[model samples]
Target: MSEPKSLEGVFHLVHMIKRHMHEQIEQLDLNISPMHMRVLKIINKQQTCTAVDIAQLLNRDKAQVTRLLNELIKQTLIEKVPNPEDKRSQRLLVTSEGMEVLAHLTTIDGNMNNKMMKGISREELKEFERITGLMTENLARAD
Candidate 1:
């Protein structure tokens, strides 16, 4: 039997689009990578969270999360504070600089999403999200 064309095309398109978005961010002057920006976004939204929070949220390892936080701190885009309840734990927070970065990135993100949905109606967008959510659940269960 032949492979399903629609599935293969969707996979390739997702990969290509993600790669292009990364490339676009790479052209920016920021010292952070796309991964770091993702972390910053979570930190920004949460106000303060531990490295473990990021690790769990991103489905990444704690060591990797630590390294990313270290780099973000060095770049002055995020600040680390001692967790009030645990001296050994640290919480991450986005700096004013980080917010500025997020603001610009948010604009780009909105524009990209808008472009992707240009011809799709609101109902179509909702259906797309529902289908994607189901797909995500299926994949998670497969693991």
Candidate 2:
């Protein structure tokens, strides 16, 4: 296999990681798809998250975020409570069941992180994260 050293390599790595993560998510009996599970995580992190907030965080369109939120609601993984600050918007939160799933996903995430970073040092990882962040900002600005 060719060593990945460019932006294409970074994207390839992301795709491979996503594939394995999706497989791991599929092994759970929670009935939520990997996308829905990810939405749950966003809601869990931001108790007052709006669909717009989630859309921005995910770099997805508002319509797509709404679709994912709808699925999460149908599966009882997340709930949309009335936004006290804005009558037109609803705040998203993860349900008790979703929290449980998050806990399980946390373990899965840790395992994946460990395996993916086996030989990489902490400093290298930090530098990688910094570069990725810069790249993300560049893309965001281009959009």
Candidate 3:
């Protein structure tokens, strides 16, 4: 029989995409990791949320999100405001600096996508998104 093909290539692709994006950010001398960017994006989307909410939204552990949020705060990318309803949990506030950097990263993200998928058509992109979503669901089920 011929060599068997596997979905391992998809895993490799995911790893490389992450590595490449990190390199791209490093080139910009931002000193922020991809996960840092992810956390910022999450906070920006939610506007005023807690670390717990962020962890739940990203499906990450609270400890991990707390660490990331700490770094973001140190970088002045996010601020913690008192949660009126719950004094125990503070709400995250995205700073203007954070929004500015996120906007820049968004541009980098778009350029990366365009460069990586130069020839892919709209239909192909849509199909890829659908398949990837299904794959994510399948992985979650397996877990």
Clashes by residue pair, model 1: none
TM-score of each: 0.87, 0.87, 0.89
| Candidate 1 C-alpha lDDT tens digits along 1-143 | 24487578769968866776676676666666778878988998886688988999999998898899999898889898889978999888888988888987897688668777889999998998897798789879994
Q: Cα RMSD (Å) per model?
A: 2.3, 2.6, 2.4
Looking at model 3, report the run of 10 residues with the lowest lDDT sum: 1-10
* Residue-wise C-alpha lDDT for candidate 3, range 18-60, written one tens digit per residue: 9888888887778798889888988888856899988998899
What is residue 28's positional error in candidate 2, in angstroms? 2.1
Residue 115, model 2: Cα distance from true site in angstroms: 0.6
- lDDT of candidate 1? 0.83
- For each candidate, the alpha-carbon lDDT, in order, equals 0.83, 0.84, 0.86
Candidate 2 vs candidate 3, lDDT winner:
3
Give the poorly placed runs of model 2, Cα more than 4 Å off: 1-5
Q: By descending lDDT, how would the candidates be arranged?
A: 3, 2, 1
